[model samples]
Target: MNAGEEPGVVAMDVESTHMPTNSEEFVDAPNFDLETYISRYEGFSKIQRLQYIARRCPRLKNDAYRLAIKDLKEGCNTASYKEIMATVGDSLGPGYGYDAAWCEAEDRKAAAARERLELELNQFKTNLIKESIRMGYHELGRHHAARGDLAAAFKCFVRTRDYCTTGRHSAE
Candidate 1:
């Protein structure tokens, strides 16, 4: 209904609107004010500055985000740590609280990468060792047979048999 239209008379210009049925359709409104916070404690120490940022921006308090910020600052410490800190704070602003989530995700990703690399390395080592054992067995068998010692050749061939077995569950 139009705000000033009569109860019995519908306004031809009034448009009917449907309310949103899902929360996902709603946009999050920006609620944090970074400039005001910076102005309030520009004279504070480094830790104090971080604490204020953490309080003002809940994302900054997240372990991942804080660690990322710290890492970034340390990387630039050789030049000027304070400048790096200021830049990170300015860049993050109200987004600081989610920093920990981002950092945690990154850490998880890195750990997975390292695990994959180690697995590949271990596989490579296993293959190399297996090949070496096979070669050694063949060489020993050939040497014994060349000396006309059939009994010794048979023993060497048997010892080399264990190396051909596959799988981690196979005998060492």
Candidate 2:
């Protein structure tokens, strides 16, 4: 920078969140005394202050602080301050920063569990078909056939055929 150039108007790259100055940047704080609280923890990093406030005064730990602390930590320009504030604030039941990503991850786990259960059920049904046929339980095969499950009856017939040829059950 030139000697006569203004300090505040220094040319910056497109990726700067905070100014390269010693002064702390100011942001709007509604519904709380955020500025004074910031000054109280002026020497602390935004993350540190948030941790302290969350531990000491959870009632006073508002959304604004969470957003600022997250912004300081992540350094991504994806979310507006208010959007971040609402996400950090509105999450309930317990704990901190239960954002969209966390919820989506949980949903994925539940879906996977459901899929596994379905697979286990199908395998159990296949085993039952094989067992009923091997035991000469024609009534169970006839019941399945009456239910319009020809595919299951065919599976049972195939098992019976194999058992007759090999002289051993499919389970063996």
Candidate 3:
């Protein structure tokens, strides 16, 4: 970090996503700009992003489901959600299934959790897009899709598509 040192790269130890608070880092970190990073780094594609999430959330059942669903929606050739869910069930180990009442209750709880997680993910994606777009030039949609933030990603993709079509007509 010393000046006149040719700005040598400093290696910082980023915390691993395996820890419980690792996911929270994505939310709390100010530099977690989905759009900016993706637009800047050509190496981080949609497939790579999904793979990263799969690696990071290996045991987290719902995370895999969410990641797979987002990847499929974003035109990724990833394994289907059912496949991921089956693996998740196996990861959950034996005797994970419950009887009728318990199953119903768990389903309800899962549905609620999914809804909440989707809302939060979309909100984060939206915020990043809005912020990055205001800076102009870079596309904000790709990062959302890459990170499995499907709702916001889809919204941004549609907007980008519409903008392009509108420009084409205006140019004509």
lDDT tens digits by residue: candidate 2, 12-60:
5778565576654343334566556665543225545654454455565
Cα lDDT for residue 36, candidate 3? 44
**What TM-score number comes out for model 3?**
0.22
Select the stronger candidate by TM-score from 1 and 3: 1
Best by lDDT, which number?
Answer: 2
Give candidate 2 regions above 4 Å deviation. Answer: 1-32, 39-44, 69-97, 100-172
Tell me the whole-model lDDT of each prediction, alpha carbons only: 0.47, 0.48, 0.44
Write model 3 residue lDDT over 27-120, tens digit each, in one string. Answer: 2233344434334433225435544545554343344345444444434322233344455554433433212454345446545655665565
Q: Pick the candidate with the highest TM-score.
A: 1
TM-score to true structure, per model = 0.24, 0.23, 0.22
Question: lDDT by residue for model 1 over 1-172, one digit each (tens)?
Answer: 6687778985553355566575423222256444454444321134346554554555434432354445433221212233334545645455342244444554565456445644653564577776556546555555444333457657756765566756532342
Candidate 1's C-alpha runs over 4 A off are 1-87, 90-98, 129-172
